[model samples]
Target: MKKYHFIAALLFCSILLQAQERYFLNSDTRLYTSTSTSAEFLGYFKYGAEVQLLSKNENGWYKVKADNLSEGYVPEKFVGTRLNAADIKTVDNENPVLAGGDQYYGGNHLFVLVAGLKARALPDKTSKIKEILFTGDPVPVNYLPKNQDEWVNIGGNFDYENAKFTLRKFIGKRPDFNTLIKEFDKLNPDAIAERKTVAERIVELAWNSDYSKLAPAYQRYSEVVKQLNDPKLIADTELNVSIAKGLDKHKLPEQIVAFTQKTEFILKGIKTKSLFLTQKELVKTFGKPAKTASIGDECGVYLSDLFYYYPDLEVSVDEKQNKAEIVKVFINENNKMILNANSVLDNTITEKAFIEKYGTYITASIKAPHSYSLQFEDSEFRIEFKDGKLFFIEIFFYC
Candidate 1:
């Protein structure tokens, strides 16, 4: 038997905001004729202005009916459901050093700021813009949000986690759950603590509400179990293909398969306190970048040609403070790889394979030739396909 629960009533908050779907402009935002900035400049929306949402493309760009009743594409950064910076709640900032006018990242934390935004002195809506930061800026954080995912206080400046501006991953294939679990049973727990984390995350996602996400979640759950037993479980494709062939397609399999990705990312982010990054670790890994960039008001470093090679990595720092504040790894066509930081993936895989590796991306409504973006509280992923081939995969890591 399947358990069903209706969340449409709870979703009314979003529904009431728009008769259809609607969004707000965070700044005096521009609207383009299409997704590219080089396209025609349709017009601009005033700060805090609301616009009717027409459609959202696979790459996370929005096609909106602007104030003048014109339609065009707007990047997701300047457009959001929230009206102001003050909407994000911040942890107490009583550090005496902050009062002394010293602005340095805590060195213990790194955050990826998802929007190209203006930094405000306070987290309140009325605060003046201190500076502007472009989308994908790896920001150093003084404090991490306790349990919520929507807001981040970065370097004493407040930034909201915008849908387009955060960390994301591109989609590939999904792993079949049938054989994967048999492998799961074969492995022993690496650590009691990690096993506990996995169990807890499982409990957290067990609700039957979004079975669309649940089935894929179960697939991921198995992957995590295998990883804990053998760090390279997914890396061994010979073993993985065999595992997939054995997966059972039972009732409510979608909900069951969709289980583990959240747990994997959350545990990774929380347990590591931060993951494989810091100002020093980045420089040490890739050396000083080949070039420097100034997007909006923030300084960023491009380790390479970006659109050409290794598009997956982004590192930005606050040079004055000599701190590496932003770190990102976006997997796109320019830097396609079989083995990512966590799993091995390629184009031949289905949406299911992708869900296990990167969680849900290409939604049921999106398919070949169209793109879609999935927003997480801390990160975002965009999946794009064309001519029946998957070409883009992007991920941003924000804490």
Candidate 2:
């Protein structure tokens, strides 16, 4: 009798929970039609979206409804009971730069743009751009802030910081101010001139640390001072003493690797157009690509197992011996961002020199007794040089 009652109670609780199922977005995920990722994309569910759980598919997906009445299936793991946005950790949110002044900076790194930025050859604003730092890149650099001008060095280029960080979007207090100051003090430079320069660099970091906090439309208004002011580092113990008074331990966000998007390079270092997707994932992402020989991309797609065409992007899947797999993708000139950061596609350097900068490429092939082409797997990138200078690049994918 007790066993029978327990079973009955368990069944009732399961039914009640099922009737009122609720789920919260733990991370950003795409809503799909079926349980597999290759399913049709319904829409994007951002972090902290509240959703109503309907039922589970046998393939480990949860059917849910958003407030907009849009229904779709999302992966089970990315959904949870909590809709806490604070728990979502990203790199920029962690170790946020804190209080910076002309003499001190909280954060110490420079983040460049995603589409590559030109590094000016000199400190002056009108100086020529010397190098391009690819987009979403951060340089391991310390700044030397002077007056209203802010500069960043990318491969000998002294570019303006304002170009990228126009407003205070992710600025905050640095978490390691005390430690940095202590380390600076410990650096015992021998000469007075060297000591002064080193000390100035340290102070400049702290001063520029809080620079990213500006939100107002930045103004470069000319100033007229009524009286000449001393432009030296005049020390005042009373004013300087308060800086260490109320500083609470600034905390950093938890470190986490972000999820990759479909367009991202799957391999860590070797950058190609390959996505490592199946036929379903490919269709879901690129929509229907030119497949049959009768209907094909103007550029053509008969040789490969399957081909996809976009003006800026082209993909070709390798045909396995028997099994159908998409391991490799070929990229054309449409999306040049595939050229990794700092790896500019310029005819300024020889193929050998470019390979030196990137290290030994995927592989090297001998085209003739004296000449040869560098390659990796079938889907790897190829570098072609003309008159000893790089001329063109081609890439293919191999799953």
Give the top-scoring candidate (TM-score). Answer: 1
- The lDDT per prediction is 0.39, 0.38
Query: What is the alpha-carbon lDDT for the whole of candidate 2?
Result: 0.38
* Model 2 CA deviation exceeding 4 Å by range: 1-275, 278-287, 294-304, 309-353, 362-381, 384-399
Return the TM-score for candidate 2, rounded to 2 decimals. 0.20
lDDT of 1 at 183: 41
Q: What is the lDDT of residue 387 in candidate 1?
A: 43
Question: For candidate 2, lDDT tens digit of each residue in 321-391?
Answer: 21123323322332222333444544355544544444322222111211223333333344445555544
Cα displacement (Å) at residue 280, model 1: 2.0
Q: What tens-digit string does per-residue lDDT give for candidate 1 at 216-242?
A: 434545555565566543443222332
Q: What is the C-alpha RMSD of each candidate to the true structure, in Å?
A: 22.8, 24.9
